[model samples]
Target: MSSSFDKFQKRRLISSYFSVVLSVFLVLFLLGILGFFIINSKKLADDFKEKIAMTVFFKSEANDSILKAFGGELKTAKFAKSYDYVSKEAAAKQHTDIIGEDFLTFLGENPLQNSFDIHLKADFVINDSIEKIEAGLRKNIMISDIVYDKQLVNLVNNNIKKVSMWILITSIFLTIIAVLLINSSLRLSIHSNRFIIKTMQMVGATKSFIRKPFVMRSVKLGMIGAGLAILALIGVLVYLEVNFPDLGILDDKLLIGIVLIVVFGLGILITWLSTYFATQRFLNLRTDDLY
Candidate 1:
């Protein structure tokens, strides 16, 4: 009967450990998902910003020398990501394709101006930056006009700010909840072993000695949980990459690395701290409080 009881206790302890690990895995997985979403949202915002190109039209009499000089300046511009020159002929051809008719036949000449469609870097797409850029570009003698949808730029910027704010708020709230839940699980697990701690203390075991094993065990469990969470995150990313290639899950290695580090770091750090506090609570309690 004594041997059977000991075996039963061992199984129960194993079950408790498993439960803690499982709880931590779930929390960390959700946190990883949120982190991935936040990173991708930023990428999407930049993509939108970069797509708002500024079309710089040239004067009707602008010659090849002026065009070449302007093109060279655009190539070396600090704010420009890329630029594509569209001659009047090419522009008219594009217009013809769009309208499904040759406008040049009726007009007797190509009316489109030679222009350079300049795609700005993501960081320079803001209102102030764009205004400054336009001001500087307008000073060119051969440039006729610079045009882009200022309204579209404002819309994208405003919507991004709003979405980012809400995402930040939600992330903070969920992180707090995750910590509390993980801490609660650790406390309960520690609580179950309160008598063992008290007994070790009564036997003249040093506090450090008592803590070392529990802390190490908890750290190991935390590592296991974190590893599992990371694997799950990777699996999800793989599935997304395979099924929806356009989302570009596998393209940004740096962002994915950061997310993985965060998930693993949070798992280890939170679990260690929660376990330390949870174990300390039991270690400080009176024997009578163990009941």
Candidate 2:
């Protein structure tokens, strides 16, 4: 009977250890997905920002010197990333190429005016800055009109703001849910060993002494989980970089390091917190409650 009991106890111990390991793996997997999004969020926002450009249309009869001056001034602007000078002939050719016919032949002359396609820095791609730049361009004598899809720009800006807020809120909500779920799981795991805890108490074991081994085990499990999560995250990032080279620009080392730190810290914190609370509850429970 003693040998059978010993074998059963050993099995239970191994099962509990594996259970902790599995839980850690699950937690890390969830965190890895979250971290990938959070890390790439800024890159996504910058891509949207870069797509917002300003078009400066010239007067039909504008002198070449006047157009050159306007382009030169815009080139010196702090917010301007680059500018493309689109000649009337080039614009007409573009239109013809798209239509696959000579629309210019019907007009007998190129009706398209020479323009500058202005690309702005991501920081200055906000709606207000674009509006301000448009207003500034209007004061130039060479400019016949400044054309941009104001509504589209506004929509993009608003959507970015909304998405950022949603990401933050969702991350927080999910983290809280994760903590609660892990805590409950730990409590249940500890509850299974209530008799062992009671027997320790009867033998004059202090609460700290009783909690040390469990806490140590929890910490070790947490570290292993965090390491697994980091590896999974790196694998996903590697896959993205290989398949989508454009995303490689967003592989910021600093941001990735920060994410790893946060993941490890979160794992340790959650594990410690759950273990502490579980042990506390066990210590406070009545002998009758154990039954």
Candidate 3:
């Protein structure tokens, strides 16, 4: 009966350890999903910002050569990404296409100024940066006015900032929750070994010596859990890519690699810390308390 009881206890311990690993896997899996959404959202935001263009209209007195020179100069500027020059005729045609009539004929001549639409680099798409660029451009006599959707710029930047802040707050909150949950699971698993800890202590085992084995076990569990979670994350990513190829979120190899590394690191760190503390608690307990 005593031998059977010991065998049963060993089986229960193995079961409890597996449960802890599964719990950790679930927690890390959730974090991985959140990371995927965050990375894609940032990529989309940069693409949106990079597409915003400022139309620099030239003065009528400014010849084609002058407008052409401005375009060439913009290419050398760090802030400018790319540009398209629209001749007066092309601008008039565009306006006519929109209005469904020949506006130049009504005005008796082509009143539309030759302009170039300049796309700013992603980092320079903010209101403050555009204001500075506009001020510098104003120094040129041949330039008439710069036109862009100021309200759109304001809306996009403001929304991006809010979304970023929320993501950051959410990430932090989830991380704390992850630690608590993983720690709790690990504590329960360690609780089964409380008697073992006390026995080691009574036998003159140094705390470090007793703690080392448990910590190593925790590390092994964490690596296995993290690996399973990463596999699940990869599976989800593959499913999404296969079913909805247009999303293109999984295209960023470097970001995906970083996220996986983070998941793996978090799993190991949280488990190790929890195991170390949990073992310490049992070490302080009386041998009778193991019952």
Best by lDDT: 3
lDDT of 1 at 256: 92
Question: In model 2, what are the clashing residue pairs, if there are any?
Answer: none
Candidate 2 per-residue lDDT over residues 1-291, each given as its tens digit: 999999998998778766766676677668667877877877777776777768889988898988888788877899888899999999998988999998977788888899998888888887788878888878877778888777877787799889989988988888887787667666777777888888899899999999888888888877887788778877877888888898763468887778878888887888898999899888998999887
The C-alpha stretches of model 1 lying farther than 4 A from their native spots are 1-11, 33-44, 105-108, 199-206, 233-262, 286-288
Q: What is the C-alpha RMSD of each candidate to the true structure, in Å?
A: 3.6, 2.4, 4.3
TM, every model: 0.79, 0.89, 0.74
In model 3, which runs have C-alpha deviations exceeding 4 angstroms? 1-15, 32-45, 59-62, 92-111, 195-210, 232-259
User: For candidate 3, lDDT tens digit of each residue in 1-291?
Assistant: 999999998999889889889988999999999999898987779778878899999989998788778878998999998999999999989999999999777689988888889999888989899999999999999899989999999999999999999999999999999999999999998987787888889989999999999999998999999999999999999998999886786799999999999999999999999999999989888777778
Highest-scoring model, TM-score: 2
For residue 269, what is the lDDT in candidate 2? 88
Q: Would you list the clashing residue pairs of candidate 1? A: none
Give the per-residue Cα lDDT of candidate 3 at 196.
80
Worst 10 residues of 1 by lDDT: 42-51
Give the whole-model CA lDDT for all candidates, comma-separated.
Answer: 0.90, 0.82, 0.91
Cα TM-score of candidate 3: 0.74
Q: Write down the worst ten-residue block by lDDT for model 3.
A: 282-291
- Model 3 RMSD, rounded to 1 decimal: 4.3
Worst 10 residues of 2 by lDDT: 247-256
Instruction: Score residue 257 of candidate 2 by CA lDDT.
Output: 79
Give lDDT tens digits, candidate 1, residues 1-291.
Answer: 999999998998898889879878999999999999998997778877888899999999999889999999988999999999999999999989999999999899777899999999999999999999999998988888999999999999999999999999999999999999888887788887889999999999988889888878877888899899999999999999999886787888998999999888888898889988888888888888889
